[model samples]
Target: MTNDPLKAAWQTANIPAHDDLQAVVRARGGHPVMSRIRRQLLLEGGCYILFLLVYYDFFDGHRRPLYLNIILVLSVACMLMQHLNGYLLASSALKGPDIFRSLQQKVLQLKQYAWLSVGSRVLGWCGIMVFFCTGITWTNAKYGLLAGAIIIMGVQMAMLWQLWQRRINRIKNTLAELNG
Candidate 1:
């Protein structure tokens, strides 16, 4: 095997050295999806924090029912927690004694978080909708508009599900290849 030209060629392939790879990783993060997740975490977390800061006065949260206010805040809290978990998972994707073990751990964690993430998003959306629509008398136009928003969020949920599927499958395939 050592003397075979094909084996030699494969063994000596021009993979980037560890430091160079690390530098690239530092520049762009591990995977594009992971980077996207991290970016989303920051963006969503920022927006949620902004809403928390301004909701009382700007959104008339002060005049809102105490239960509604609590529900809204709790929903936002769930969303923030979801984002934080995703960010942390993305950051730790490559951190382990070895790549295989690291990815294995990630897949496990991902499986565990899948429902939690989806549930949080759904809860947050429903909570926000409830909080916003509480005082509004629903006309045909209002119902139509709310229906449209609900449809949009439904599509978003499907897309998010697909993204999770892709991310998890890709990592699993990578792990399988490494095992061989």
Candidate 2:
């Protein structure tokens, strides 16, 4: 309200009103945390798309039961949708009102995705089990398939847990620093 000449001069100048300050903020690169989150989201989103391609190639027109195929495709689609949504959320955070609020939203988004990862793992395991039980009969060769599936599922779950923990902790650490 008072004395700075620069403030007085700026107040006296005729400047066009901005429709949204977000555009001005966005003209500059956003916060570092947002950049990191965006990169992670893009990488994961690309992986999901790649997974869908591979799944389609491997399973399409196969002897696999229709229900199993449907479930697998739907599951992949759901996972992809989640990743895409996360990516959009992360991108939007860059345009948020302030750095702290942006960070808070990013953390919330990461946490939500971490929980989604757990759900994705559970859904995958259940889908595999259901596929085996309902669609495939137990045969001599099927034992290998069952064993391989179990090993792969175990590895997948372990990796997912590690990834989830790492991502969540990274964001939490950033939040802690910001809060402190």
Candidate 3:
């Protein structure tokens, strides 16, 4: 791996079409599997970040609503698990044997993460619904909605930025391989 930390990280984490496209391509036959894995990882990471934002915005301070707190806590846990699973998939995809095997493992891990993500989201959505239906003051409800929206956008942007960084590193690796 190159001395560049970002490049090295990308090389180890399997972000396709980055600096080391040639080696990555040669190693994996330019298979679509790598791209698919990358996309899935990005999506999962984005979702987790969004969930975190929602937790922070509304639940960070003040007396916690019992039902809302429980649901938020569970959602945060699930999101954390999903984030870890994504990182694992990225590392395994880069270093693991065959692309098929790597993908299989990624898919299995993703399945679990997906369930968690869905559950967490559901809990959050339901909590919001209940809060509104229970006739909570508009001020509280508005804050929750605002927080949720901010988190959604923030998480998406963060995930995309991470993906962009990986792509740049991959590009650098490709350049090095070509010149060498």
User: Best candidate per lDDT, number?
Assistant: 1
Off by over 4 Å in 1: 1-39, 93-101
**Positional deviation of 89 in candidate 2, in angstroms?**
3.1
Model 3 residue 138 CA deviation (Å) reads 10
Off by over 4 Å in 3: 1-65, 94-99, 128-180
Best by TM-score: 1
Error of 2 at 124 (Å): 4.0
Q: Which stretches of candidate 2 lie over 4 Å from their true place?
A: 1-66, 94-97, 125-134
Candidate 3, residues 81-139, lDDT tens digits: the string is 65555556554544357544544455455555555545555554555545434534668
Q: TM-score per candidate, in order?
A: 0.77, 0.56, 0.34
- What lDDT, from 0 to 1, does candidate 2 have? 0.70
Judge candidate 2 at residue 55 and give its lDDT: 61
lDDT tens string, model 1, 22-119?
78977875668777887787888899999999999999999999999999999999899988987776676366899899888888889878877888
lDDT, candidate 2, 24-116, per-residue tens: 656777667777877877787787677667765564426766778777767666666666666676565354787777777776777777777
How many backbone overlaps does candidate 2 show?
Answer: 0
